[model samples]
Target: MSPAGAQPIRAKSRHHRLQEHVLETTTSASLLSTSYLATSPIAQQILARDLAECSDDDEDEVKFDSEDDGDDNDDSEEDFSTTLHGGAAAHLISRPSGTIYGTLRPIIASQVQGSPAVNERDLAQSRREERSLLRDNHILPPKHRRPFRESALRQLYRRIFSTKVHESGCDSDVGKALESSPLLQHDYLSEDASGPPSPSPSETDVLWDCATVASSNILKTTWQREAKTLAQYSGPLILTFLLHYSVQITSIFTVGRIGRKELGAVSLAAMTSNVTCYCVIQGLSTCLDTLAAQAFGSGHKKLVGLQLQRLTYMLWLLLIPIATLWWFAGRILANIIPDQDTAALAGLYLRVLILGTPGVAAFESGKRFVQAQGLFHATTYVLIIGATLNVLANWFFVFKLEFGFLGAACAVVFTQNLLPFLLFLYVRFIDGMECWNGLTRKAFTNWGQMIRLALPGMIMVLAQYFAFEVLTLAASRFGSADLAAQSILVTCTSTTFNIPFPLSIAASTRVANLIGAKLTDAARTSAKVALFAGCLVGLFNMTLLSSLRFQLPYLFTRDDEVAAIVSRVLPICAAMQLCDSAAAISHGLLRGIGRQRIGSYTNLCSYYLVALPISFATGWVLGWKLEGLWFGVTIGLCV
Candidate 1:
């Protein structure tokens, strides 16, 4: 209880504090080292040795603490030195206590609290190594996948749901090592699990900032990649759509050369056919987009053929009633239309078109069949051969053979039937036959689900097609000149639309792929690029229409009155191109994200509620006519 006793107690207290500090520092440093070292066999051995040394030092301290109280004050420093120099921990902390806390303290401090540059470099290197290993093992991060060409619908479902299986050996030693190591599991292999705990506010801010920078870099690099991808997908689609639509356009061109009345009649007939037959067939065929793709994606490859057969059978059955309507179309047209000659001619065109109805049905269903299997180029090839034959047939039948207006109808019927025949040949011999499982009674059985999906799709197509057709029908009331002009306008606008429409499809596919891969930022960037491309396309179309307004109409009609009316109205249609392209791309983006219902609703409301009514008001009531009709469409697109 005297000064000598107090002095020993003070020295013991100091020694105790030093021991505590060393223990705390060593434990923290070991944990930090373990994080980086766990993947390496050599580092793991060193960690084990260090851990064992720490345990021995703890035992030595316990033994020292339990020693007799009278003999320890002079021996305290020697004991401390002995503890510090005895094992791997002592070697790690080689400096004497008097000079510094020992070498391990400074190294640990430098790692934890020194320059961020060194830490960042090490962290970056660690990440690079991890990524390299993942790549070597064919283990992609959940947010990324190797790009490949696949069906858009398939990509959408597969990517979004993470249903795609990689062919890599996930049972490899690297994978096993990754799975066993807690640190590696936490960092790389656990993303698909419940994920890490939510970061704190400050941590979240830092993460967000880092993500923003990363996203910016990704955008810069991926923009060209996405654009190139879209181009590859869209190019053939554009040609296919144009060539298919040109079947109708050729009819208009050939018949228009006959006279104003014939031009007007063909326009009316085409509109009627689109509304009653083509659009309905197209809409119904949309079921295959989901059905065939799903069946193929689910590995039910035969079901794709079954779906096509089912839809085709349904369409053929539906064609019976449609054929009846077409047979009586002349009489039906005479009752509603004021121009009897135009009506009768249109009716004649429809009657001839009825011959092509079965072909139309076959081709529409067949397209989805091939497309679901990522055979988009198949349709393009068919259309190329078919479209060339169509142009030649129209020229032969209408002019060379001098079958006149009737020859135009004949040409259309031949081309219509020829398209399916060509597509069938492609399927039978070239490709897409893998899906076909021979005609089965199964096609007759599964009509209900197809009908349900078909009806909505049909309605979606009907809504858009019907609106334009209605405008054409309305133009009939103005006179043959206006009707002919309307036909030219419709043909031109529809043709121009093919550019952006195909681009939209490509964009939708890309965006859906990214979204399915769980790359939200990448998807967003792709959408932006698509929209920008749409804008450029819109601008190009606008410029073309505006500049070539006068020249373009003459291609469809020889009638000066029709051409004059078309030239006057073409600029208004041109102005609508920008809005049209933007809307198409926006819808594609929405579809990519599985929000297509929103697009469908918007399209219905915008056309029915905003566009059609305004068109009627301005064109009919306000007497703005064709220009007013298009003005309403422009406004609706903006909405």
Candidate 2:
């Protein structure tokens, strides 16, 4: 064969390879546009540019082969091929007479022949044209054209739940899909490598947005899978929350048996301790959800221990003031309460509780530390032992030893202190020791970040807790019968809350994990399942409370008046269960989306602005008493 004859055959082979490459690229772009590119301006621009380049090449091929073809029929076939392969590109190419592809193709080709500087200039020009095309097409919004300034919180979340961790796992179908997706890999790598220009911050945002959207659509998660995950998480969590709650309720059961005064006093003391101390401890330790979990997830194992220590120290220091308040609480209660005897007994219970404050602090912080390392069962184990001990101690001290109301307080104090010790033994002897560094001086330093996160959490918790405690205080104004009945209502509602609250936490965990994995649709699906589960739990609680309304009060108190008042108000409390569960689960959903501030604001406004005023008006002003107070609470939960 002559050299001229050889040229056409090589050209034909090159044409076939280019055609195949163009076909694949076109298919990929179509799939991407359908699933992901809709959210990504930068990706859309790149695909458009590639199509335009292919169109230009086809036009050049047509021009070159036009003279060789004898018939008009061959020219028409070439035109149809051009339109079929790059219809959008043909339209785009025709609109821009001086398209970047027309000018840069020669330079890009020449760069393979070693003209580096001209190729660099041509590449820069190509980028500018891409941006212009993006803007003209209205693909990139003007506001988003500027550098995307990520919020500090979002940046921190990304850093904590980085793609490196997900890539390492590749556990789920979604993870495997992400790992296997060459289109996504190419888009991500192109920005990092020297071949393509790095994307601007806005473009970077668009790229990730595309990936997330595409992954969510392509890898659809089933409702059954989400429900199973929720069940796994919530089952143990429900038991743990219930057992932990039972520690206080045990004291109520023992103390309530003595008399109506003791029952009201126990309720008053429990409310006071919870609002002033336990809620603060829980809230401050909430920082560990982010801090300790981030540290553990990022593989800084010892930082988890340091966080725990710092939070524990903060709590112990805060305890000094809390203990003082409890010691003098009797005098404070005496001035406020209509019944001096009940106030004195309540204050005595608070004073006894002061001994257990440090233990509560340690346990709360330690619980988070272990949970951050995925050691959820450790707390459950400790609570099982602690709750059982509390029950037996309550029975022995109050009944066997005949120590009266103070014995229930003693039993509570013993259990509260014992819990941290039990948790410590588990951590030291069991699974979570890897994250525990020995007590260090570093724990005392760098308190600012922890405190900053803690204060807002504390305030949010206080808002919710204080709202309920205020209802307890308001019921006191109605006298011992109403207050004791209020205690039963609060206990029943709180016990039922344990079911849905834990379910919500489970749902939140599932949702947050899905969001981190960029499974947006899956996260949304999980949230819906959680809400549905919450509704079911709420219905169960409602049925139980309403059906056993008369009998349920006798379990707490033998007093005829208290039981009568409780029976009258029990149905109202049962009616609030659905609303209560929905509210708790909704808050969990908000937390999952990193929009907990919205939940906090809503809680504050609904409880304070909506619920309390109505309670005050109906309970006191309209003489509806306990029933009206709960009606207000029900209204608040609805909001």
Q: Candidate 2 lDDT, tens digit per residue, 221-245?
A: 4555566667866887778778888
lDDT of 1 by residue, 46-82 (tens): 2222223333432322222224556645454433322
What TM-score does each of the candidates earn? 0.66, 0.66
Candidate 2 least-lDDT 10 residues: 107-116
Instruction: For model 1, state the Cα shift of residue 531 in Å.
Output: 1.5
TM-score computed on alpha carbons, candidate 2: 0.66
Per-residue error at 567 for model 2, in Å?
A: 0.3
lDDT of each: 0.63, 0.63
Compute the lDDT of residue 195 as modeled in candidate 1. Answer: 38
